[model samples]
Target: MTVQHEPDNWRKSSRSQNGSACVEVGSFGDGAAIRDTKDRAAGYFTADRDQWSAFVAAIKGGRFDA
Candidate 1:
């Protein structure tokens, strides 16, 4: 998540290895854009910088423990 990127430079996570069932992330200004690798034309889900950072932080901190 520390990497900076230009628009449209989508990259799927390296941890993804289960067929095409994964997502891709790309930078959009200080924010980011995400889309399904299985369906590129399905549109995207976006998050601004703050939201993106918080989300990542939560994951790293295990705030989503089930």
Candidate 2:
């Protein structure tokens, strides 16, 4: 399997508030990266373009809503 690298320009989620559960995202050449805003030193995870798209779609479709 191919490995993905973290992106350079990470930005906090727009829906994030002044809370400890916030996250940040960054876009790489062919994918995206996600990291914890509260523990940046913990590093991050990356998803390829297709995976990222699917995740976003699921979110929009409320697949993750409580």
Candidate 3:
């Protein structure tokens, strides 16, 4: 199901560099919303709770590290 969310209370990634693209996330009902730091007005992605948890776990496990 697609859920609409308004961005607020965003926390930025600590790994973000000063002059690089970044993202911020905010909590919503039973899920979370993500937005680009460079163009927040452009758009965002909302993930359900389970999906969000798994995504976080993958990050912790270095699944996307290069």
lDDT of 1 by residue, 7-58 (tens): 5688887888979999888988778998888898888888999999999999
**Tens digits of per-residue lDDT for model 3, 1-66:** 976548568888787788648888998788898888889888788898999999999999999999
Estimate the overall C-alpha local distance difference test score of candidate 3: 0.85
Error of 3 at 28 (Å): 1.4
- Show the lowest summed lDDT stretch of 10 residues, model 1: 1-10
Which pairs clash in model 3?
A: none
Residue 62, model 1: lDDT of 100
Cα lDDT tens digits, model 2, 1-66, are 866556779888676777878888898768888889779999988888999999999999999999
**Model 2 segments more than 4 A misplaced:** 1-6
Clash statistics: count for each candidate: 0, 0, 0
For candidate 2, give the lDDT of residue 45: 86
Cα lDDT, model 2, residue 11: 86
Candidate 1 vs 3: which has more TM-score: 3
Ranking by TM-score: 2, 3, 1
Error of 2 at 37 (Å): 0.8
